[model samples]
Target: MFSTILVPIDLAEPESSHRALDAAFHMAHEYNSDVHVMTVVPDFGMSIVGGYFPEGFEQKALDGTRQRLDEYLEGAVPDNVDVKGHVAHGSIYEEILRVAKEVGADVIVMASHRPAMRDYLIGPNAARVVRHATQSVLVVRD
Candidate 1:
C-alpha cells in the first residue's frame, strides 16, 4: 500500500513511459495514493559547456520543461487521480531520487528501455535509480 507514487518520465520520449504511468495509476487508484510525475532537464555538467549556450538558456529550459510537464499530464493523467508534477534540473537519476525523498514517495514507478551495449558501460537512469534509491522501485519495461 503506497501513500505516494513517484513516476519519472522523459518528456522527449513519453511513449516509453506509458506503461509505467499506467502501472502507477493503477496502484494509485487501488490505494488512494497521490501520483507525482517528474521530468528532469539534464544539466550541462560543466561551466564551459554552459558558456556555449546563450544567457538565460538554463532558466528558459527549466521553464519550458515545467510547461511541457504540465501539458503532458493534462491529457495523460485521469481526472480522478490526485497528481502533482515536478520539473528538475540536474543528473536525471539524482533529481528523481531527490524528488522521491522530498515528496516522501513510498515507491517509484519508472520505465526502462531495452539495453544497448552503451547502457552496460554507463548504465541507464532506471538502473541507477534502482541501485541507489532508498525506496522501493518498480521498473516497467517500455
Candidate 2:
C-alpha cells in the first residue's frame, strides 16, 4: 500500500505504459491514495547560445502534451478516482525523482517498453531512478 503513486508515461508510446498505470491505479484504489501521473519532455536544447524555437515550437509541444494527458485521463482514469497530472521538461529520471520528493510519494510505478540503443549503454532512466530514488519503485517490465 502507498500514500502516493507516481506513474511515468512516455508520450510516444502510450500503450507501453498502460500496465504501469493499471498497477498504480490498483494500488491507489486499494489504499485510498493519491496518484500523480507525469510525463517529461526531453529538452531539445537550442542549437547555440541565444537560440530559440521557431515561433512557439516549445509551447506547441507543451500544449500538445497537456492535451494528450487530458485525453488520456478522460479515457483511462476513472471519474471517481483522484489523480493529478504533471507535464515537465527535463531529464526523465531527474523529473520523476523531483516529483516524487515534492509529493512525498510512498511509491513510484512505471513501465518499461523494451530497450533501444542508448539504454544498453547508460541503462534506462527507470533503472537509474530505481537505483537512486529514496522511495520505493515498481517497474512494470513488458
Q: Which pairs of residues collide in candidate 2?
A: none
TM-score of 2: 0.89
lDDT (Cα, tens digit) per residue for candidate 1, span 1-142? 8999999999988897778999999999899898999999999998889999999999999999999989989989888887899999999999999999999999999999999999999999999999999999999986
Query: Model 2 lDDT vs. the true structure?
Result: 0.86
- Which candidate has the highest lDDT of all? 1
Summing lDDT over every window of 10 consecutive residues in candidate 2, give the lowest-scoring window. 44-53
- Candidate 2 runs further than 4 Å off: 45-52, 115-118
Give the alpha carbon lDDT tens digit for every residue of 102-125 in model 2.
888999999985788888898988
